[model samples]
Target: MFTLGTYQVHFLTFWCFLKVKRKDRWRNGSKKKFQSQVDRETEFLDVQESDQKLNFKLKGPEGEIQQGTCRYLIGAGGAHSAVRKSLGLKFEGGDYNNEFMLGDVHVKSPQRMKGLHAFFTKEGILAFFPFDDSGNFRVIYGDFKNFDAAKKDLTLEELQFKVDQVGPKGIVLSDPSWLSRFRIHHRMAPCFQMGSIFLAGDAAHIHSPIGGQGMNTGIQDALSLCFKIYLNLRRGAPFELLKGYEQERLPIAKDVLRATDLATQFALSNSLSTRMVKKWLLPFLIEHTPLQKKMAETISQLAISRRDQKIRSNLKIQYP
Candidate 1:
């Protein structure tokens, strides 16, 4: 992996493959790519929305111009969504000032990195996620004191220097496969839909990677939308039936945005008081059973409550 611009975040320039989270786990082969994963090669030039249909213009893989029209548009195209921009939509959010870095490597230690492991330090926050039992890990670190750290051409040695300061003891990161420098944000679009065109995923909202909520929330956004679209198209439902998409999803997005922004600030805070809170308060809170249960429910989306999507039960897609 190479460097990616701050706006271009999360699975932006990779092999365009990842997993969707289910009740059990998030694991899938390269062939089972997320429907929303857009390989970096594609570019959106412009999008135009209308009463009858939406017109889209884009640059394809081969540097050729392309244009098309569709009756419905769902913008799952990440933060810089073409469809959202075409409609003059506001992606309303602010960026976290701390410069951050991430990469995949193997941690040389016997400790099982089977799940998320966060190391809160005086410098910033270092998080490790295990890929498998072979010690492979995805490491994310925020540099609170070193804002001037190189933004591009990030090296494993640079990462090692920082990891040695903040990472788990006796665990050495090695055989680095990918490294990247990026900034994160806490923001959401003001609305999810306008007319027949709609926005979902990062197109509608984006937040810090603190809770690992980006893809899971976006997938849920698509889920809230897909059946609604089916009802409108296949079951002769009213277009107004689709407005429930925003009603159902906007609150969830708003809540996620608020929660993540707060957590990120708390995690990456440079203030001495906040660092003390992390050092003292957070560890105790982490061990709280109710808090753990709430975090689990929120991560799995079981705690999400829709406002106006009860219509889903009455509406079903009759496959022809």
Candidate 2:
């Protein structure tokens, strides 16, 4: 991934084929954002609405309960968000049938490990991503068929098997730091705001892991929500300021989900014709300079815009 500036661009990772998350960056940044309120486990139990106030019941690990009332609540809970569930908001998409295995392992590769590499064969698709200067690589094995069987946990030997099957011959996977099997979903909440509670991040939308836009989109939601709330409370702006948060972000989420779905479909293609297209057509398309620049911007999420959108505080915001 990359961040383009006027004169210089920062290469966040060598992987452009797929977007990868750097947990350390998120953890450190979040720590700096909420300096004092760091180690709290907040279990949201219920949200009650009475008169004009919304009361939230939260439970702690020790069974301690607390209640707080606010005019607005922002639900940043991840996928399967309780807040969105309480509001009866359903995600709008289905899970992909294919399953993928991901793991971070110490790998020694003969080929240049600086950039992301995808080995596509009739067997399956296996991609390796080098995260840092170290040889620690994130490997993904895509199984478009045998969904049920592929859902099983990945073993070290199984990782080796997959590597031998699709990855470069000399590359060796060992000393895995993390391993898991998962199925990806593409879903977005119909509406971001209901009453006074607003859904953000995974609570709002989720898509294939291809572009890794999930967390980035959610962080954008938090920033927009916070700024709107700040304006309404501190500057005596109308609550309509918050409506722009949804108007601006929801479409961006939809576009991201669409992009991810397309990329994932191409990556996980199993049919002969699709495989040929992926093998030949895709590389040809990506070779074009203009298309390459556009893909970079789209993958980096620099193309999302809301120039024509207007902020309206009169928009209905439910609190319960």
- Which candidate gets the maximum lDDT versus the true structure? 2
Evaluated at residue 123, the lDDT of candidate 2 is 65
Candidate 2 on 1-320: residue-level lDDT in tens?
A: 11111011223343332223456666778788878464368698778778989999889878899888989988877998889988888888988888688888888878657656666677667776666667777888887575675345779788888787666668788888788888889999999997678999999999998866777788778877877787678666677667778888888888899889988887777777877776667656656678767877777777765422333233332221
TM-score of each: 0.81, 0.85
C-alpha RMSD for every candidate:
7.4, 6.7
Error of 1 at 11 (Å): 26
Model 2 has an lDDT value of 0.74
lDDT of each: 0.73, 0.74
